[model samples]
Target: MSDSKYAFEPAQFKVICVPGDGRCLFRSVAHGACLRLGKPSPSENLQKELADELRAKVADELVKRRKDTEWFLEGDFDTYVQQIRKPHVWGGEPELLMASHVLQMPITVFMRDHKSGSLLTIAEYGQDYGREDPIRVLYHGFGHYDALDFHPSGAKSKLFQK
Candidate 1:
């Protein structure tokens, strides 16, 4: 196996549906995260609406599967993880940090296969402006971390979703 590198990279996401719903089905194939919905592009405010709807759906789905609720929880969780979890809470321009709050949900990380699109890679660790080393926040903590480390790979190897 190849060694995983801990560095900043743009995360990717794929929209999918929940299993029984003929129409309410969305999956983030890249990340193995699945979702179920009732409509296709259901609302006029598509982007924001989907984020809100998916936020709840993703949380429910993660909970049902005994997965950490990090992927599903949004808003405060994102801010807390991106900002406070790492020992160093103030890294770069404060203005850039503001943009992080704008996202309604956690961005799924993806690794593209040779065939075509990207596959989801569970984000076990994240970078913060204040800390020199990446922080491996606990998914169960909703982005909270108890310690700081400088390992190349953020979290323990066993943490990936699948």
Candidate 2:
């Protein structure tokens, strides 16, 4: 694959296959960084709702693709979510971070278990691109291993880590 294939193109969509179990690596388009529909609120529920919307968009894509492969959402938990929302609060401000010309669109899939909010893959669809966007695809296949030890397939690193 060429570099452009991995690079971001507004017209193109990127697919990241995050593994739920060790077996199937589910896929979802790497939508641009998460942005609040309104000002940030002090409610965790609000954040969760926003995340759900984003994840729903990804899920909707999965359904349209009809690939029948399980996909997942990956992120650094709430810490990262807040960080992205208000990067200035942390050392790496958003302006500076964006100045670097790369965006770390950290996303967490909204569907999750009642206990652990860690990475998860659920069934649903939310976004519709109308069949035109650059596409990025990833896959994971490790069915025999236990869930605790399972990992995403292919390169074991992040997609856009600077």
Candidate 3:
């Protein structure tokens, strides 16, 4: 992706691709959680396990915050939560928001600008948790999400330098 709109070279960030199974969103978030904590990336098997664990937590979070979330949900809130608890179910924006609450950390989502070929910040969650050192994830605009982390050089882009 081009970095023309920002002050960092593209090489400073690396995308950690996860399996495109229906749990991609959760997998991406799990991977990002590791990076946010300055921990080494988890192995593929561990990533899947973490994703499933996170999916369960997110479901509980949605239920716990039902008063705030149910209104915007599409179907029976109970059913939605039950389905989301399953391992292979897919998650979208709603789940992403709930993830922020569950993890109590900020998540920054980026999407590739199709026309400009640059990455754009499409959505951010968990501002109350603070904006520093957010977990970054890239949305493919299809049905996939991937984790984005700093390269070994530990460089901070101007966009993120604050």
Candidate 4:
């Protein structure tokens, strides 16, 4: 049985669903992070590149700390690096950090637990970032994402009809 038994009431909000390819996490992060960029970013590919760079920075830091690349990755570090640089692979906290840095805004990820009936922030950047509105994303899990739009009552959006 799936642990995702409970769910948010669909009628209460609009859920923007993105592609479920291996890159969904990065794409969602990119959308939220780009809102405060002052101008639009060229594409999702650029944000993916930013995430790859962030991971590379982490690898460099680990090397500086004398940790072998294998400690945090598999096979050859260079190959792994190349793989992540391309699209489709998932990115986690490191990418979030990079997105936060690149956008100069805080990112708040809210993760919901149907089992426990709760929701909370899974990641956050400090308040020092200059932007007015923080970029926020709803993190469904390691593999998927979702967004809720609070439409006015009695207005049924055709896009999200049950």
Kindly list the per-residue Cα lDDT of model 3 for residues 6-76, writing each as its tens digit.
32234456778889889899999999998888889999999999999999999999999999999999999
The best candidate in terms of lDDT: 3
User: lDDT for every model?
Assistant: 0.27, 0.25, 0.82, 0.52
Better of 1 and 3 by lDDT: 3
Q: Point to the candidate with the largest TM-score.
A: 3
lDDT of 1 at 83: 44
Candidate 3 matches the true fold with a TM-score of 0.86
Q: Cα deviation of 93 in candidate 4 (Å)?
A: 1.0
Model 4: which ten-residue window has the lowest total lDDT?
A: 1-10
Model 4: per-residue Cα lDDT at residue 80: 57
The residue ranges of model 1 lying beyond 4 angstroms of the native Cα positions read: 1-3, 6-44, 67-162
Identify the runs in model 3 with alpha carbons over 4 angstroms from their true place.
Answer: 1-9, 151-162
Q: Which stretch of 10 consecutive residues in model 3 shows the poorest summed lDDT?
A: 1-10
Q: Rank order by lDDT, top first?
A: 3, 4, 1, 2
Model 4 agreement with the true structure over 25-94: per-residue lDDT tens digits:
5556555555445446426566556444555554444344334334556667666556655556665554
